[model samples]
Target: MKSNIIRSVLSATALGVLSSSAMAHGDEEHAKPRTFDASKVEATAFGQEGNPKKVSRVIHVGMSDHMRFSPATISVKRGETVKLVVRNDGQILHEMVLGTKEALKEHAELMKKFPEMEHADSNMAHVKPGKAGEIIWQFTKAGEFEFACLQPGHFEAGMVGKVLVK
Candidate 1:
């Protein structure tokens, strides 16, 4: 009986150690650099590309009078890199925010409360009229994301687009 109990305890301890080691291995794998395929990136809407792949996919969006965006639908593949060139042809300041639908919804609410809640990270780019800016994004997952102008009532006025990443 004593030997059996000792064996059981040793087995349990071994399992615990193995489990911890497996978790650590998973963490290490997650730390590795991820690659996004350029071929998978499809240009659903573009303004006028000097060179589609070389000059980057240029998306010429117009923000005029309260809210508006040209070519409001875009498609892409999962794990793809895209360079979005946003041009503001309006008279007011505009911004382009790229994020998940949920993220955009939440941000919209936050912006409603605080008009200065602009995401200045890699996910968003702000440009003034007659000016152009770029946003390089890698769609890591397959889902529907939203690209919108979060300038107060812009999104409500049809200044939003769908980014289908599949």
Candidate 2:
């Protein structure tokens, strides 16, 4: 009877852990509420959060276990809003985080320090394996911007991309 009770407790604990993570993936809501405020989003060195209704074009990017983003070089016209559809074709978790080269390097280092940190922002899309995510952004300036999978050592593995706003 004691063995049975112990097994039940262990099984319950495992299920709880899985259920919590499952809540953040697929079509399920995030484990924590996303406090993204579209209206309050401000313009950054790269751009600003775009209005879904104003997206002028759609770009599809594929992330793979090889630590690379297909079509890593992207081009966009200034003042245009783009619907960036990021699909993870790998068997592991990945994310697309848009920022300047300097910022990306800093963030990547932070991720290395805290591997289990959960980061959610308007300029980021965390995707599970075989799943997808989206980030709508408006290129309000004409400059270069960088993006990478800031997942621990993923960035160091060279999972990065670039956007040329002209």
- Say which candidate scores most in lDDT: 2
**Local distance difference test, each candidate:** 0.59, 0.80
Query: Residue 41 lDDT in model 2?
Result: 82
Rate residue 50 of model 1 by lDDT: 19
The top-ranked prediction according to TM-score is 2
lDDT of 1 by residue, 66-138 (tens): 5766667888767566778788787777778776565566556555655533234456667767777776666
- Candidate 2 lDDT over residue span 91-119, tens digit each: 98888999889777867865665454544
> What's the TM for model 2?
0.79
Provide the TM-score for each candidate, comma-separated. 0.61, 0.79
Report RMSD (Å) for each prediction in the order shown. 16.2, 11.9
Q: Which segments of model 2 are wrong by more than 4 Å? A: 1-38
